[model samples]
Target: MSSHRRVWYPYVSPFDPCPPIKAKAYSTPPSLFLGYQPPNLEQFTPMEALKIGTLWKVFYDPWYSPYEVSTEEDQS
Candidate 1:
């Protein structure tokens, strides 16, 4: 018979007893590898502006400011 060694990995079963899992708080936000940048609004057309504005209204906080109320009326 040829001499050979066999290795075995410990098998974990569902019925096996496990220690209690502890939750850890993160000090910093997780990093995202995706190269994502916020959209630039200056290049948007009137139609595109309206569409984006409508969508933003549904959320509690919208990122972009489409309009600003002026205290003084237009003299023109």
Candidate 2:
């Protein structure tokens, strides 16, 4: 299995006006890893498919916000 998210460092110059960013992260689609659909793959229910945005379970990659702030109650 491969990582869904990847990170890379951008070129930073000392002569730049603003502060430089060290590393940046980006997400790739799950379909890129799948070569072809198999005969009988697991599938999500109708209600679940509508909520998840995908009918196939293998293709479901939940989106997580990088800038989302978690409250103290959510930690538990």
Clashes by residue pair, model 1 = none
Query: C-alpha displacement of 33 in model 1, angstroms?
Result: 20
Q: Each prediction's TM-score against the native?
A: 0.17, 0.77
Top-lDDT structure, candidate number: 2
Model 2 C-alpha lDDT per residue in residues 1-76, reported as the tens digit of each score: 5667668899999999999888887778888899888879899999999999999998988655556633422564
In candidate 1, what are the lDDT values of residues 14-69, reduced to their tens digit? 67689533342222211132235346423445576577553322121222212442
Ten residues in sequence with the least summed lDDT for candidate 2: 67-76
Candidate 1 ranges with C-alpha deviation above 4 Å:
1-41, 54-76
Model 1 TM-score?
Answer: 0.17
**Candidate 2 has what TM-score?**
0.77
The Cα RMSD in angstroms, rounded to one decimal, for candidate 2 relative to the true structure is: 4.4
